[model samples]
Target: MNDGWISDEEERTPQVTPVYSQTFGRGGGRGRGGYGENRRARGFNSRGNSWRDEGNSGGNTQRDGGNIGGNTWRDGGNSGGNIWRNEGNSGGNTWRDEGNSGGNTWRDGGNSGGNSWRNGDENITTLAVKKNNVGRIIGKGGSKIRDLESESGARIQIGKPSDEDYGMTVEVTLTGSEDCRQTAKRLIEELTDDSAPRSYGGNSNSGNSYNVEEPQEEKPRYIDFAEANRAYEEAQKERWAQLPPLKKNFYIEDPAVAAMLPEEVANFRKVNNNITASYALGQSPENSPIPNPVQTFEQCFSEYPEILTQIYNQSFTKPSPIQSQAWPILLKGLDLIGVAQTGTGKTLAFLLPGLIHTDLQPIPRSQRGGPNVLVLAPTRELALQIEKEVKKYNYRDIKSVCIYGGGSRRDQVNIVKQGVEIIIATPGRLNDLVQAGVIKVASVTYLILDEADRMLDMGFEPQIRKSLLDIRPDRQTVMTSATWPEGVRRLAQSYMKNPIQVYVGSLDLAAVHSVTQRIEMIHEDDKIARLFEFLHDMQPDDKVIVFVGKKARADDISSELSLNGVSCQSIHGDREQCDREQALKDLETGDVRILVATDVASRGLDIMDVTHIFNVDFPRNIEEYVHRVGRTGRAGKTGEAISLFTREDWSQAHELIVILEEANQEVPHELYDMSQRFSAWKEKKNEDRGQGRGGGRGRGGGRGGGRPRW
Candidate 1:
């Protein structure tokens, strides 16, 4: 009767007391037939036909001497019915009675003696689980649950779906023995381990559990309009704080020469002299001498009077800003890195310095076999051009030779063996000559790298390094480029002694002011027609240079132009050295009015009287565009540059707009609109990349967007 709540461990063993009664009732009464009874009996009673208790010697039964319900029994008397009694106090256990008319029947209404039901019919447990892990617990088509049931011998019943809005967990009921229930619970715990809530951006902890719900995406924190504007202003201030201070008008002075300039001449110089210069002293004595700059070529030639005659003979009036500043540094035999607008007398800046140094210390016949000065250029055309400038100096005692590839190496060796004081050559051919023992740099005192950035871009760094290995360590190194990129800066730090940097205008990549740019958005198919139309409007005397993207295109365009009655000549890398030289010569002379070429002619090609440049195909980069436009406006002459762009050039529209705006050129409306579109696309691309999506447009890749080279 004490079955209120019994634990499995506590129900293993129980105690019971036997009872004998004739009729059971819900009352406490004593009778003669009762074998065992208590005054306060709160136990079970079973209904039966009859039961008798006698004081027999063989059976263990107790007889009460009290009457109950007016019934009595005699002691030591045997009844006509069968009587059964379990030995030792086991009589109160579950008893099965076999009647003559039927099978055995178990009556548990009597005292069960604290014995538990071993059939496991009452063992049931319910567990709450995360809804996300219910699928894993149930598995594919209930396979996992069936396997779990078979392994643990437990029947699992999953309850109704969870109400996610209220954060209700799933209910799962398990019915089995203690061991089976414990095993099933452990398996479910392993399955639902990853369902626990995790902090944002934290890694999952459960091993190979895929039933966890994806974490909700956090909303982006957007700043208000006022806050965004404040942040932008602060960022602008920080950026400006990091920039170097601007340099003002501080021209070098030369006291020996005096020349009174007309108002027009002075005005011209002032309008064009937008040069910026910075000087850093190399490892030298505290009192190391520095030379003063000059205002005019006459002042620059005051110390070297012989150079004045050469300058006058060449019809040179005055020095450009770069030459005006660079002349003094180079004359003092200090290292210099000159950056100036293309066609702004950069060739003469270093040339005059080298020539003056040569004039000051004339190399003897014995010391002349090896050149005292070595000038390395990036391309053969540039090297040849430098050689031509050297010739214009007309140094009688200072002999110089120009050597490069795509020409006769044996002939160059013969020239080198004949003896020269200055050797102007490209890096590859010069390195080859030096390795062949035909050229020696041990006696070289001056080293100049013209278009140094272009040389590095053309993969000539190794050759430049090899040429420098045998050169004298105390040599004065000079590097000159129209645009000074970071690579050029690093090159200077590695090779030059604390060098002086001389720049004209801002030291940023931009087109020259003298050249007027006209950009047209046209289709590729219409380019030829546009070129013809442009040529028709051009003057006959105006020498024009047309730039194309590839060598084959150069040839094709040149042929088409020639067929259209526009006398033209093409030159590229694939042309023979003699043919290419002739083509350039024909263009320089009046033999051909138009010259079509690739980027090969972008740098160091100084043809006189060039009035216009046509970009039949746009250059690969802004720098190349600057250099190409620079081909026309030479020697301070104003010129025009016209470029045709297509859809392929969209990626470069933003940069092109910036260049035009910086140079004060009129930007076309189409270009500005395309640039805006490009900006939006760039922003979207960056956002995608930040969200773990793939990015676009790697550096120096893709069509029309690769690194521009000459």
Candidate 2:
């Protein structure tokens, strides 16, 4: 066990109920590319009709006696059904470890509905689990699986191939009555409850192992509940305009009324988690559905004050879920995969611990490469955000700097020479410095990848392999992100060791469910006028951010809005670096309430007290949606996100739903079906609107002009 695995407590509760233990599987060596957000890679498979789902679901495998007429087993699964139970000689069966996709953490998702009473009828089922996770499911002493089988009342079976076979398989054969089959299906479905099926992507069509059809280009287009309601209202108004002033009801024509009805009306919340009093779902005398354990930031500080002071003068303002769960794991140097919504304080969840480890051990002077910690973010904005927060935490002694592209390379080089204790940087910029031999990462003991999913999506995998992963093979790593894509998962698996997984705010369809959502759909031709209407309707003091799809559009829209007498400014790559900085400053100081930009502003940047978010254009991805909304509703305040979509923007809306659902945020009933059929209908919809694709856009968002620091 690498000395990092937290050994189980010897004492066991009497009359224990077997819990289907699935791990996000983490715990890797120090300084490797295996840092950032939780994503599932290969997992173990074992006995009878079992499966693991979503981010919250974890896994393990084991085997021994009763093997398919042969030897013991390791990693994947056993030959036949029986796992390699007994500890045999054969050089301690090779542990078929998982790719660094990250470690599994225990979330206590909920209890199964009891052993499904499957009659030995023809109700066959297929339960597929990632091959690397077999050990955790089976656990030591064969007790884990036994409890699962006993409690579930379903014949659980795990299968793997002989050494000769390159691939591993776990099959659960069911022979039971209809009652048993129904029960089994219920239990299996509940496994990956919160998470959707993971579909992996390939490199230039090389082929990806995991596949669920790419979210189809949903047709028919999606509309927010408000939009749907508004349409209904409009249709009603037109009818009323023809009748007497008091006339109403005008027989419903919209199919949405029936389509939006609550399923089962009031029947036990069906699949959604209604009973959240416990840690997870389902209830049992022996096992509570949820593990509502709380970890306060104060407690974390009490344990690592020096670390806290080293990073910031004042302690963290709040202990977010990431910090609460991670302080314990990271301090112990366990590999971890943390999945949470954007801006939920995921950075500190690992940063504090990495900082603490440095303080406790105190990397003696003369040790190579500068500091013991390294944090990597996907975007320049995020890296800077982390750097700013770290700078606050550094208090008096520790030093760190944010390095990103577009900024002066010489300035970054000079900062490296200053002996920084922490380094926060973007993959591309950081890799450039490394290749230039301007910085050395060899001595770095702790590595982190914030926004890992987006980083890969942003096309930084190769950079990650070259710079982050190549830094050190054996180091403690922590990765965090708002989404857990298959690409990110594969990257994590290849890099992390046995790691712990952590997820927060998956209860609703989004991260900050508190944020009210509204969509304003205008005729494509009338979008500009409608946007003007929205601003005209806004209170002068309100803090609003208007997002566009392109940097040029941001500038053009800002010009147009300002021409219309609205106080506005835009931040895109083309603006001067100074101008970009100035624009952000202006927004922060209330000089400019309506700030326009592209996805550049859609990341970890924390411009607080934002009262509203205007999606002048649909976001490109779900992660972008989270980051954009995150700018508002921060510091424990309520906020609203207003999305403007044309019919063509439907696919983007559907992606948003998928992202929100994965995050456990609820999408009002009316919007669910529409969200799925969003593609083509929304595709041509963009034509109805246009932000501006004119001349310039900068790298930072648009390459704004500024004298090179060099």
Candidate 3:
């Protein structure tokens, strides 16, 4: 074994069973061919220590006048008073007489301590392992780490390093001592599908702990970003030079689309661009990711009959693509990375697999730290949404909980200790629990990174990286998002294991399905009335999510809506975590569906069945717009995205339209016209400025030029 975790049983024989016999048929009987004169009837003397021995036969009853060890075998399979009382002794020939059905068994095997650790039936240990790569140490998802931990009753941490660490993560750290670590690692070598050498690193070399910090031989040379990028490119070339080139580039046949790309981008020989992406990855693009052929929302109830019966008969007539791709992979206990738009069942993709895994194989409550399946969403709302959906699937004997920044620490801690089968949470709050020791990530096996795009977004990256490092590298990983930006691409390179990139729709193109998108050009002052018009037309049940720029505006819009008799509430940074949760709860329960909120709620809030999303404050950039409209068109349901752009707002989003164009999506003619008009207006203004400057030149040309808002 790489470490002293587990040893091979074949090499060493187990000791034979020892014998301790206390012979007596105390209460056996007082029978004597009707004469009641059988001296062997040592009955009426009931010591009442019943032991079952399988050697006795022929329904014989012997007390004395017999051997040193006597057993009375009554007829009728020893049912009734002569049946075995209790074999309370430490495992030998254990027999039980419960009602009419009890078997007398000769347990030929010794204590086989290994079998005692088997997690069967409903009791399981939820081991949250840090995900680390294989060939280095622990196999992917800490597969080897998990085995070791389970066998030893020890916890193992497989720390995945941050980008600064260059994708190099640590291996298992055994929670217990040498013996525990030994048993666990031994199991790893034997049980794993992998036959390669197990990774060995640590002070004691027990295949546990990333705690061993090896001294560096020397300081590595550093380079600037551009120079480093160039070196990286050259190094890739040199690496590829040794291997024979693939006959074809990218292994994909869409040459027409390929032809449109830059020569370097489409180069069939360039190691950097020709194709180095994972062979396991399939083409989902950004839009129209692999379609989930399983069942759609409308058909869900019928598809999983067992789930339907167990969980509340929630309607699920159709299954999303993420769900389809993710379910199969999760069932096999393999790690995966799912790339899809927000609200397209990304939560379900990971949560469903985790639920199924837990339900089919239940674990003990104490060991099942919150949940076997841990879901990491980007925001509180999304976590809550996932938690709610998990409840629908609760009939399978699995429970789910949500943890995020805007919630009670005390309550979260209490429930965490109570233990749940699954947890949907944000990185920030979950990290707090981990640091406090109230939570242990070494127990998590199945992990999902929801809204992976947002996690890579600025400010959240540190927490995401830390949380990821805290988890065992041996667990399954599922990352889903509406947009896969460059940052996400780099993240996938480091964490995902031969990932399959599937997109429901390109973030640039598919966000506006079945939704009427109108780019109305108006002045800044006219925007509010425009919103009022839309709200006026909105039906009572059509819950609206109005996005605004300033916190003041969020409140202002909500006030206007309320004044106009539109049931609504406003949420912003100033709101307490409880109020935010309550606001989300209000929206979910249909209490106050028409809500106005700022950007915090926009990123990962999963407000289900939102009929419309009004970009009252159009995103400063196209990417933001992509995320904004993403709130709707979720889970395959069609929704509308309306933007009231004043000249100022329109100027901000014109590039957003251009980005849409680059993605090969259609730009509404109105948006295109608005862009041209704005350009014309700018030119006129510039022409006026040049003329004025010419006039001023005669007097004196000014040094300063006024910058336009656009």
Candidate 4:
């Protein structure tokens, strides 16, 4: 017997006699190697007999062979065995009499627990553990293995490496009851991870060398999407909170202004302010009172005779409403925000003052560090146009240049180095030059941000902020926008210093009254056919600007129109800068009477005699629609704006009606029906969704059980 294996029966032989009495017969004797034989021979039936037979019968009994029931084990003179025995009855009582009944039982000598063969509950299992993990299972001084044995009631054995394994792995053996062996194996796998080792053996017969590689350590990184989104929202909120609030509007009364003016100036104010348009002043401080509007060329440039002479040379007639109020505020060296329609003279409103501010600086042009005036435009076309306006008034020969993306970088850099007083640039190229050290902002005393709202929408706020970071805070700043949106208000609050606002009309978004707005509800397939029909009725010398929603659509329409014997040109962001410029030039020079374009030409474009604005596709929003219609009715000219609306644009019907009503234009009944139908469909969809989510219950708890605004 193994010294480590202890038997419960041997340890308490005297105490377990009573318990063994019921299992064994009352007079059964216990003897060395005779316990199983005595129980099977004395108390149990003999081999090859029936289960009920105790003593063998010499003569044939009632249940004997060939009798009715005698010797049931070999009844009917059968050579084949019955149910419990095999054929010939030689394998007597296979289940009870031969194997388990007398051999291999707990009452036998195998009950000692040191038996070499396993009984029913005993089990053996093997695991292959990697060399590196062997120490993990054994622990310090084999303490872990000892604890595992005591806890699981299992015997654990470590074996030497086998020749085939090449010492890369060690074998672990576990011996115990089934449950105990399983518990110990699970514990070892948990401690050592029990992964199969990697082996690169060439050959075992030739005793070739083996290569083994340790598993690489794994370190994983994670990103929290929810936390990242929360942080981004927080950053945006903090950025918005840094700016001050916008000041309220202060009305400009005609009587108060006319009381202090001459008759000529009073008539000008009466004819223009509050009648032809509205005027309002805002955020102006009491220390510097606001200046009166300049109505004429003489009144505007009376202090500078050279400027007046240049104005006459350029055929000056009168001041536009925006220019009339904007010039006075900008000329006083105060920050100004000019809000008006797109066709209003907003460019010259700030440009002339910028030129005057640059030329009149205390430092001479040569001594000033770089350009003294900087104009930031949203598009290259607008920048070039502003530069052209600056050239028209050559006061004191003030040099200027326009630099933008897709232009010759070397040429622009050379122009900057040659010492210009005025610099017109788009935000992108201006930032690039600033980073490249080719332009300086420290000496820029006059700054103008044209089309401020468009610049914000195009995601140019970062470049604008970076460009302004180095400029002196006290510099004169002027900003212009067609609509005063919240983003534009926040930007103005951050950059301007109590700027005075001079808006020509109502601040609410409205189309120009000069443009006769018309809407026609049509099918999507009929727009092309209808377009040519509209173009056929065009009067001679009447120009048109066709606005589409996308670049590809603009090219398609232009090509179709040209093939149908109509002259046209297409312009969009994807076109080259020179090509866009040429397209505009062709339209203005009547080389092409129709200009097919996207929203890129909606704002800051000045083309004379553009008698009509046609919308091939209604704009994405009402704000863009307003800007597109304003393209034709510019410079006090009357024009017509026609839009083709389809069912796909039903989502914008409500907002389009509001704009049309504000402009006093007719709203078609079909548009109202479309809006009503879309609303009904949206409400029905939400109802069905709510019913499904609530499982027939009325209105689930959160968010009314359905999403808002499909």
Candidate 5:
């Protein structure tokens, strides 16, 4: 038997002889029984009979005289012909039959005339694979190799790297039967075919055939409109379930006061105080009370006489438009939704009316487990600010406590146990106390949600609902925000009963007219230098608030400004409550001329005499921009708001332009151009999206066709 070599090529022709050779004398005559005379084996037939002769001989010998039978032997004359055979019938055997007319040797036992090539023995086939494709074939951590082995039932082993300076190829060895080897080889050929590189429009290599395929354009994926609507409806239902329930036994016993005369209403809608056209009065009375414009606090302080004395002592002479309008509706015991510019005395508008209502029917001290009013603000600073204003109204007799997160809970608990008449808190901390039973809201009659839009934006809707559930059903709710979004309207519809919506200006979400806004398009690298330039122009006595986008940015800019001899104090959400209070106090008392802050100070911050607002980083949205600029230009004072815009603010360019144009401020050419480009891009995006829905092809209508619009 000869050892055979396997080639790496996929196909090869067999070169081995199939006949078994014998070194014995040749037989002469043919037997009449079965043996044919001078017959030679071309190849093994299906019966495995093959014959070859070597030496010269004489008369022939026949096996069984006709058929090749088991263990049959024939001896020829003259040369001492001897034949030996085994009939064990094991399938795999190698025959080395040598006959010198003496004898023949038989090794493993198998059928005498049967095919002895068994497929059970292991056979190995090796393939050389490109080095680049080995990792792909192996997949992540040999997952593909395991899968291939499972599918082909072949054990595969990848060879170690060789040091030869030949082509970069790795050896992949497969060990299995013939069929298994063929299956695995076919699979590997398919894998290599897929991994082969082909030029899209160029000629192929002269030595290699390329399997070029024309790329197919992907089609746009359109969402099923009915499925999307169903999902949206389900989500809305979930949100509604979390909302506060309406009062069951509560009803408006007395109708609202008669509306003020048309001339009086017209006087309230003077320049710089025009009511927004989009304001809606839902379920409001036909004769809802419309208070006349008052120039002094005395005219607006008719319900509570003690509030008048406090007003006189504090030198409160006049009312802002929001105050004058909100006073009448709130005093009439109706729900109120007020939308006014930031820093327009909205805090006092709600606080004064709430106090007057509290004085009308005071909760007895013995039965007071909670306060009579619950004021919910978005942030700790605003909550504290509200508490301060409540104190300013000569509330020595009417006790109030301020509670928020990051402060001592024990102290708040103690204060609540002391029978306070009012509680001002942030939603999170108030909800915590309510759950712990440290504070209760069942007896609370008045609820104020300040900066309601911000609260909802901060994902406090669920918390707000949980807190509202504990309060009385007939509670008088007043929600005030700089912008009235759809969420606020939903909130009113869910909780407030016949809420009278009051808008102090055009509801178009514009910056305050008292603020002169200047937008400069500059690179981010030049922002620090431009800020220094503005600082040089600012006087030492001028109070300024610089707004940054992040807390880290606020600290960085504040430190830089302070190092340059500017008295700057920074405040952000991470700052301790005491430190934040001190920072605001420093800015208010002229101890620090510059205050650096994030959007935490954008709303409900009443720092009097803020001469300038520098937006070192733009706000995230247009409503935030309005509120950030509103931090300055308070108390009927003309102030300036300067913003530094960069390429990152391109999406906000259109909104910035609208705000500037509405305020009658000069819009920079660069900003206007960016706004126009942004508008065009948005229009094109919408058009493409529409085409996608209609199953039409466009520049960006294909699946994942282009960059996202934002």
Candidate 6:
């Protein structure tokens, strides 16, 4: 043991004064003797007899014979056996017994203690134990001490810490006969030793082991939230400052295209900071000149003949109404808000000018560092559709990629790493990629917020705002929406400068004029049978879209149609992106004759030659109804729309009538009757409540006196 492991009591040297006795007997002889301090006594016997001796402090005793034993007593614990016994007080004591067939015992009741051992004979010694480990020697409520005593046939006593050691070390004394002292000492050493393999919270093993406990872990400290947020904002500002500056107000380089315009067109664009028109319904800065609408494709793309050629190649003879006004405003490097119905050529209006802006930049495309144009869409399908449109008119070798959720992120990241000029993306995935450093938004100069109203309605405004934080504020922004709601107007005010407004049709909720609207008043249970009856009239080459309110309903209708030998497929938010794409492909390739879908497909998908639209479930609101009807009658093509309206949809009857009458479609008398009945029932319920509350003077009481407003 190390010196630090020893205590003052354990270093004492006993003052030995030897006393010897001899006894001879054939049977047995017994004798007991007590000695004073620091004395040694030994007795020799011939036959079956035992000698017991008790000694004072710092004393020793020994007995030798056949069945020999020794006993010593100090100020310590007690033990009784066949051969020897010991009692001691304040000092260390040693006793040894050598014989053939007997045992020995030693006890120490001193301020110090004794340790016992056996090597061919029994001896008593002293042991010093660290104060912290004394508990392991004794265990819970003395249970482990009793168990050790029973197993080793020894008495174990745990004493208080020694005074000379300043209570840093405890003394554990053992007393026994024969080899039991050795067994008990070894077990105690294993329990108190730090290197011993410990079994926590269980019984000690019989072989050689002990139960030891582990220490508890420390708790975490508190954090300073305000300081953390300040550091984060400073880092963001540093990153933004490192990006290159933005260049603005550049135009197309073709002098020939510039010459086609009147001299007034060139001077007006140079002088004014905003664009406006008398035909559009929006406000701008005072005295902002409205550029004249283009009359022909030659006028729209006169600066870029190649784009003009591509436009004519697609067989578009003239510009659409929104196009005629939007082209001149965007090409002049002014921000614009185009309010037009779906399928009115809004994609090409922003896309063409964006291509021109990108190609005409002072910095070359290769040196732009990242994509120059970012288009934020609300849905993956719309982003992909915009990508398809972008692929058709390839001007100046500009490439585009669509990024959205529910698609392979690895593939998208790899494509972004390869340089591209235009990035069409949904807001959620675009924000994710920007945060991940897969996309850098600092280089974007031309930004498009398509379907602005729909994006807000779908709860994507937070994502949209986050995506625009790193983009340059002076870039030309274009916002297109089917409806000019307050949300879209607010977004335009925050993002776009004093922008030109070009609206093709009326701002009120209206469907396409090219589609003939039809409505059938029927019971709820009769819708499926009526659907089959409508499908019977479908032409062999004609494609149709069935709009339902719920995804489950779409599946139900598609399954019913397939069972009756009609080919159909379904698409909704729940379907995988691959499956949704396959369904659209199947419908477009003439592999499926009908597509049943929710309003998710209603907003901006431009599927060609859709001959009919069936509203198996009425849309939740009339705004969706307009977009759903606009799907079939696109690009001046004539189509038909049929709807099944039941009594459950009475709340929307008035709005539905307004849309039908605005489109000049025929309305059935039964629908008018149902509308009247709903109004009457509502009025009656209000009157009943009024009588209960105001003594029959209510607004429903035919101008009766309730109260007067100033």
Best by TM-score: 4
- Give me the displacement of residue 409 in model 1, in angstroms: 0.7
List model 5 lDDT by residue over 1-710, tens digit each: 32221112201433234444332232454432123333222224334443322212432332211123323223332253333222333233343223354433333334543423222223567888887778756867776677677778886778754447375887788866678878888766666665454322111233444456746669989989999999987886775554343332211222222345666557556753775322254343456534444444655665456777887786655777788667766776777788888888899888887776666564354554557788999999899889888888865488899999989999999988878888999999989999998887877778889999999999999999987775655778889988878998888788887777888876679788899898888888999899889988987668889998999999999888778777789999999988999999999988998999999998888888999999999888888899888888887888999999987788898888888888899988888777777778678878767767856665535553343232
What's every prediction's RMSD, in angstroms? Answer: 21.3, 36.5, 32.3, 17.4, 17.3, 16.5
Clashes (candidate 1) = 1
User: What lDDT does each candidate get?
Assistant: 0.69, 0.57, 0.56, 0.71, 0.70, 0.73
TM-score leaderboard ranking: 4, 5, 6, 1, 3, 2
Off by over 4 Å in 3: 1-305, 308-312, 360-371, 507-509, 563-566, 603-609, 650-670, 673-710
What TM-score, computed on C-alpha atoms, does each candidate reach? 0.60, 0.52, 0.53, 0.62, 0.62, 0.61
* Winner on lDDT (3 vs 4): 4
- Number of clashing residue pairs in every model? 1, 134, 62, 4, 3, 22
Which 10 successive residues of model 5 have the least lDDT summed?
Answer: 2-11
Tell me the deviation in Å of residue 517 in model 6: 0.4
Error of 5 at 302 (Å): 4.2
lDDT at residue 562 of model 2 (Cα atoms): 80
Q: What is the lDDT of residue 341 in candidate 3?
A: 53
lDDT of 1 at 198: 24
lDDT per residue for candidate 6 within 91-152, as digits (tens), equals: 43344332223333332233344544443433443478999988877778887788878878
Q: What is the lDDT of residue 241 in candidate 6?
A: 70
Per-residue lDDT over 590-679 for candidate 2, one digit per residue giving the tens place of the 0 to 100 score: 888888888888877788678988887777666677778888887568888888766555545566666556545656543454554444
Model 1 over residues 387-440: C-alpha lDDT tens digits? 888887787668888999989988888878888878999988888988888886
Clashing pairs in 1: 14-113
The positional error of residue 631 in candidate 1, measured at the CA in angstroms, is 0.9
Weakest 10 consecutive residues of candidate 2 by summed lDDT? 244-253
lDDT of 4 by residue, 1-710 (tens): 21221124333422211212122211223331122221111111222223211111111111111111112221111122111111222221121111222221111122212222233323568888887878767767786688778878998878666567799888888876779899999887866653444322222244654544557788887989999999987886676444322222222234444355555554665567431222223444556666677656666666678877887886758888888877767777778888888888899888877767776666567776788789999988889888888888888989999999999999999999998989999999999999888898877778888999999989999999987777765677888999889898898888788788777667788888899999998888999888888888989888999898899999998888888788889999999988999999999999989999999998888888999999989998888999899888888889999999998888788888888898789999888888887778678767777768746454443443332232
